[model samples]
Target: MPDTQLTVTLSGEGVGDARVVVRALEQAFGAPDELPSDEKATVHMATFTGEARAEGSPTAPGHLSAPVAVTVQGAPGAVRRASETLARAFTTRDEGAASGDQEQERQLLLEP
Candidate 1:
């Protein structure tokens, strides 16, 4: 199977909060292939490879009580699964539209 990549970008007040969001992503997608630069960075990023699954770990309230943007790129199936997991983890606001033709991609804007 082709490798799937999911990149989650979190913008919030503190980096600690961002880390919490990253941890939530880790719970959903397994250990990330890459993590954000430092704790001081405002906009943090976490990249995960392969399929994403819910680990049953609950994220803290304040962690996602901000604005977050997630992007999933991979096979159609993988992207759909990742998007679903993230949508559930983030909120039930809206189902983000999917784009890209050959290489599938989905962009989700989440708010807590």
Candidate 2:
């Protein structure tokens, strides 16, 4: 299996909101080591980025956040489910999402 990325975002009041978001994700999808370790399934994690969005409201209330992007190389269905759940768990709205190889495959420049 190849490496992948995952992003989880939380949007709400103050800087502490992000931490709540992270906790929600960990609960929903499991921790970094908990994802799965297999020749066919390798889950690698990247730290999420949070920034205040003065742009008013989405589904919750005032302010918003950048979506956390996650990537990985392995099972497609599992990855997609994990991604969706992560978003749904964090906020009252679906603020988080996971984009796998499909999103990754398009960008060559991101390669190391």
Candidate 3:
């Protein structure tokens, strides 16, 4: 299988809001390499491996105190899957995307 590792970065009102986003992703992609944390910074990040599972509880709109800025990066398919999964779970605005020879990145603004 092509590398399906995906990295998700999020910045929200606080760690709690970010966790909500992560939890939604966990449903579709299983657990991440590590959970998101403040790390004394404004953003948190987590990495998920393998293809997104087909069977899982359907993602629903998660509550957020404020909009969350999310960035997904990895193999093109992996990035696309992650982005779509998030959109299904939240009101999202596509910020844009960029592609490299071996990886892709997309940004989204997730609303409450």
What is the descending lDDT order?
A: 3, 1, 2
CA lDDT, candidate 2, residue 111: 7
| Poorest stretch of ten by lDDT in candidate 1 | 54-63
lDDT value, residue 53 of candidate 3: 76
Tens digits of lDDT, candidate 3, 1-112: 5356888999978888888888888876778888877546689998888567775667563689899999999988888878878888888899999999999999999998
Task: Give the clashing residue pairs of candidate 1, or none.
Answer: none
Give the runs in model 2 whose Cα sits over 4 Å from its true position: 1-4, 9-11, 32-79, 86-91, 94-101, 104-112
Which lDDT values do the candidates have, in the order given?
0.62, 0.33, 0.84
lDDT of 2 by residue, 1-112 (tens): 2222444222223233334344444443334333222333222332422222232222321222443233322344434544544445433332234456554211010100
The model with the greatest TM-score is 3
Identify the leading candidate in terms of lDDT: 3
Residue 90 CA displacement from its true place in model 2, Å? 5.2
Output the worst ten-in-a-row residue range by lDDT, candidate 3: 53-62
TM-score of model 2 (CA atoms) = 0.33
User: Could you tell me every candidate's TM-score relative to the true structure?
Assistant: 0.64, 0.33, 0.88
Over the full model, what C-alpha lDDT does candidate 3 score relative to the true structure? 0.84
